[model samples]
Target: MSKRDLTDKGTISRKYAKKEILKTIIGYLVFYASWMIVTFWLLYFFEEIPHFDWILWILFYAVVIPFIVVLVSVTWYSYRYVKMFSFEVLESDIIIQHGVFNR
Candidate 1:
C-alpha cells in the first residue's frame, strides 16, 4: 500500500508517530521536573516560616494540580489534533479532516 493509503486507513505514519511520542514524553517530563524543582526551591527559601511543611503541602497541591490538569489537557488535545490532521511529507501539507460527515 502507498504511504497515503496507510495514513488514510488511520494508521499513523511511522516517522510521525515516533516523533510525536518522543515529543510528548519529553514535554511531560520537562514540565513536571520544572515544577518539582520550583516547589523545592520555594520550600527551601521559605524555610524560616512556622508550619512551613503544612504550607508547602497546601501550596504544592493548589498550584501543581491545576498545572498538571491543564498540561495534560493541552497535551491530549495536541495529540488528537495531530492524529486527525494527516501530514504529507512529500507535499508538505497537512490535511485536517473535521466533522462527523467528513469522517
Candidate 2:
C-alpha cells in the first residue's frame, strides 16, 4: 500500500524499478500497437478476406483468439517481471513464487 510496506517486503533499488517500469511500459505499448494493427487490418481488409459464411466466428477465431492468447502470455511475463524484487531468499534453497502484482 505504501513505500515503507513495499520496502519491508524487499528492496527494489531505484535502478531496478526504473528499468522494470520502462520494460512494462514498453510491453504495454507494443501490445497496444499490435491490437491497433490487427483491428485496422481487419477493418480495411474485411471485404478482401474470405469469410465464407461464418463471419462472426471466423473474425473472432482467426484474429481475436490468437491475439488474446499472445497478449495474455506476454503481459503475464511483463507483469511478473515488473517489480525488480526478491523475497525471503533462503540459504541455497530452490523455489519460485507465483504471484501477480508482487505485493
Candidate 3:
C-alpha cells in the first residue's frame, strides 16, 4: 500500500466561513444562556441577601460586557482562521492544519 498526497490549496468559500462562524456563535450562546439562567436563579432565590442587588449590576457590566466583546472578536478572528485553514483527505489518512501567523 502506498500513501496518497491529497493535499491541495483549497479555497475557503464564503458560505462555509459563515456557517462555521454561526455554529461557533450558537455554541457560545447556548452555553452562556444556561450559565446565565442558573446564575439569575441563584441570585433571585436568596432572600435578604446583603449587597447582592448591587453586586448583580456590577457583575453584569464587568463580566457580561467583556464576554460579549471577546466573543465578537473571536468570531471575527475565526472567520479569518477559516480562510487560512486547510484540510487534507488521503486514501488512508486525514489531516487538518490552520494558522495565520505567516499569512
C-alpha lDDT values of all predictions = 0.58, 0.55, 0.67
Candidate 2 segments exceeding 4 Å error: 1-11, 47-103
RMSD of 2: 10.1
Pairs of residues clashing in candidate 2? none
Poorest lDDT segment (10 consecutive residues) of candidate 1: 94-103
lDDT of 1 by residue, 29-75 (tens): 78767876786788679884447677677657765676577667766
lDDT of 3 at 82: 70
- Tens-digit per-residue lDDT, 1-103, candidate 2: 3333332235334565456556656776677668767765886787565455665675567656866676666556555564534453344442234333334
For candidate 1, report its TM-score: 0.39
For residue 28, give model 3's deviation from the true position in Å: 2.0
Q: Pick the candidate with the highest lDDT.
A: 3
Q: Please, what are the lDDT tens digits per residue for candidate 3 over residues 6-101?
A: 644454566766776677777767777787677767877975354866767856885678668867887787677777777556666655566533
How far residue 40's Cα lies from its native spot in candidate 2, in Å, is: 0.3
Q: Is candidate 1 or candidate 3 better by lDDT?
A: 3
In candidate 3, which residue ranges exceed 4 Å CA deviation?
Answer: 1-9, 48-59, 86-103
